[model samples]
Target: MAYTKHIPKKRILCRELQFVLVLLLGWLAPHSLCAQRVSIGLYDTCSIQLLRVCPLSAGYKLLLNGKFVEVEKGTELNFSSRGRMLICERAGNEYEPCEHIALVHTDPNAQFELSLLRPQAETRTYDGNLSLFVDFGRIMCLNLVDQEAYIAGVALAEVGAKAKPELYKAQALLIRTYLMGNRAKHLEEGFNLCDQVHCQAYKGSASKYPYIRQATQQTAGMVVVDAEGNLITSVFHANCGGQTASARDVWMTETPYLQSVKDPYCRRSRGANWKKTVSLNDWKRFLQSKGVSTERINNTGYLYRSETREGMYELPGGIAVPFRDLREYFNLKSAWFNVAVDGGEVLLSGRGYGHGIGMCQEGAIRMAEEGKTAAEIINFYFRGARIVKQQ
Candidate 1:
């Protein structure tokens, strides 16, 4: 079937067929081919079965004028679909239909596990403080008095630090309910109500029932920054295993994240999947890896650090260490360990997961039951931090 074998010498059979189908569909409903969110790993879980695809370059499937159609590789498309879109990945698939590719794979056992769940991954928090720091909607506006503002900031810190991602998201939505004309930027927009707690209310409930509706409403997003005033990529947490990290502790550098400890709301749980363990290796092994004077490992704990590429630190035995890599490594959950000795058998160790940070989920949830407000819980873990406002 050499119907179209001239152009794009690399077109596969599937893509070739797809192009023809889309052309026919376009003739009927010309306006459906305009938007395509390009090359995202698209998966449809709405029905938990069917998968529709718009490869951005290869193929496009659409239902135009009551007819199913597809546009093939290297060809333009025009069509529409009545079905709703579900999820698209931020990353593009390098290989079409890779080994792990699937329409939608449901996990039978998706129950939430505290030790396995990273709080940062939950995306929301509640510090028992008044204001919530919602991360959805790309619009966050809160205008409160000094005291309330302080409370809000403290609440954000405490909860953001201590709560998991889901909890943080829920808490942020809850706080938006009590907000008024919003922040100075938002104040520019006209509001139905003026200042004074008229718009916001103080709801009291553990289920967070009343406030949930308003808090979950869309809002602005917040950017995290480093000490250099450069935006710090966020490294969220629910618990730090009773100890949150100094920027130096995780990044091995002076980052603005180091100052994150100040947020009273930011604290980790006591139990962590990942724990720090002592590693005392002999000079023979350590120096051989360092490629430097063996005496350095014998005298002091100084390891060979790379001078060219910044943040690359070496241990006494010359194991390469990168700050960013360590940050990810130290906060892993359930990872495999393979130690390869020159002549000895490979030693394998399987360890629990997560970065050992504040308010371990299991520990915090337990504390929450013990009548600990988000503030009390955060303070207990993140030492010396005070709950304060953003101002």
Candidate 2:
């Protein structure tokens, strides 16, 4: 993984010095160095055919097939794809066929609103320029946005606007760390990342919450690094059910900083506990499918319990079933659960909401509410990790 690269301290200091000199010489903007621009694919999971773009900033220029067309602010323009060609139209204007189209804003603080018309999705406002092209029988929409703006959007989407500024700052650092590690995830697709949970759920600019942007800016060019001075995998979940899972148990990969930790902060928060029931026969059949003997199909054989997060569910005759496999097969919320055989039905009492690995969002929120700093919250969850400025 890119996060595991061990950069030498001498080289890092040299780069920081060079960056400072560049900033002093007026060769680079302050925000340009810390919060670089990134290209993100919008609505990547949806097959978009038609889109409506409205500029929210001044000095907007429309580029149609490499030619610049003057466009005023707040002008609504519609674009659609037809047989591998891009079609554009203004209100009450004829549809013009073009190979590609881009909406560029000369203003540094550019913003735009995009509405997915063909799919009839919700309209979202973004802080960036917009580019459109036809690809694979649909219109590919890309947003050229600042990294800090993108991080703010992701922080709001992931943790919501009601969280403390400390939580937002902690989340921003993790989001930025993940971005730095996985920037080339979709390089072949012509974008740095997609606006989805597969990369990070980005609903657009975080304009509503000024504090979100402030927190993101405060943590600009900062990321969590392990003892070896390499970026750490900053994974997080909704909750940890009072105990976070280790990376070795969840992903079968040993990570020194991602070990299991006791987290009591989120126990009373939402997504902490859940329950589900299934037929005893179904449970037995699932175990049988996993190669458990028929003799071990008794009522006691199907019973299991997990006081703490365990990697496997031990059955009779020394047979074991991975909790992750059970969670996937039964669609359970998390792998931390207790299995009890009640008559012909099996009740699964589960805890947590996600994979139960890494930092817990609700736990962090509670910590932040308790006046914990962003660094304290991060270090609490990710043990032995240091928050440092990116070189």
Candidate 3:
């Protein structure tokens, strides 16, 4: 412009288009980097009729029915359900019943405590906001929390507080990956996920464990993905005996990254080996229920030995029973076990403490103690999986 240069109309239009594109991208960048939020169903499995909530932070904006009210810090609010409405009482002031109640803290780092009064459940502290409503004649409590905070809490609940930072990081990655993959699991139930083992155990905030929060932050925005960039299932168990199981062997679904791997680290851990003895008659009856003939059961075909993990327990007449079915029937610790008839009881010697799929927590903890990085621990359990930042 200073040199008074002449420009063609098409050239000027192209430049303007480029500028607009740059502006558009810039505007979208912050949104892309925004932290994800999740609404978790707290005490999801309990029929909570009464709940008590108190703000641990400065204050919260209470949305009752359709009106907004400012609640000061440390104000304890009691909520009870009346058919389809939620009744909230603070101190001695009883407000009008609300169909919906939401506690929104203006501070991004707010904390709150929730306790079930009617059914009598342990009190739990959580980060972010709380939402409450009535459904199916019970009070439904939902925690709207930042995704990373939820992951940290889940990791703590899953792995406990005595893990190394690397182990915590590995668990955090898997938890986040699972959340991203299964976000819609409870969409019909009016929450993103439930605080139960069926989804992931989330007791509360991981504030007690400083290392857990640090590990979660270090691995923020990360998730495990397959070669095709799809999120891996990210399944884990307490222990795997001496080896992990394949998804095909356990769940009947073939997953490339979930292939079995010999794990040397978890053998000496607490959950490695266990033994349980059930009545032999009970075992035989269970096998009979699964179509094992009396002839096969009496011929000792039901007495099986598994030096390595097996998907099926074969009987004399070419009939096979799934190990998972046996595990469930017997309340066994794991499917990887040796079955033998000892006296009047069926002696079941089992290895591992869980389903033996994906990462083994004991093994990962050992790896972390041996200075393995979180990425290394994940790669060792999940073959050929990649840990990539979440989009």
Q: Between which residue pairs do clashes occur in model 2? A: none
Which candidate model has the greater TM-score, 1 or 3? 3
lDDT of 2 by residue, 1-391 (tens): 1111222111112343334323322323324444377777788878888889998887888877557888888899988877978888898684568766778775536888999998989999998777777767778787878788899999998988999999999999999999888876665565677887778888999978898999889998899999999999989988889999898987899999999999989999979999999998788789889998856467877777767899998887888888988988988888899988889899999999888777899999999999999999999999999999888
Model 2, stretches more than 4 Å misplaced?
1-35
State the lDDT of candidate 3 residue by residue for 331-353, as single tens digits. 78888998888788888899998
- Model 1 lDDT per residue over 249-366, tens place: 4445654333323222223433333333323334234434535454554433432322121334455554544433433433333222222233222222222223323333345444
**Global lDDT scores for all candidate models:** 0.28, 0.82, 0.82
Per-residue error for 91 in candidate 2, Å, reads: 1.4
Taking every candidate in turn, the Cα RMSD to the unseen true structure, in Å, is 18.7, 7.6, 13.1
What's the candidate order when arranged by decreasing lDDT?
3, 2, 1
The clash count of every prediction, one per candidate, is 58, 0, 0
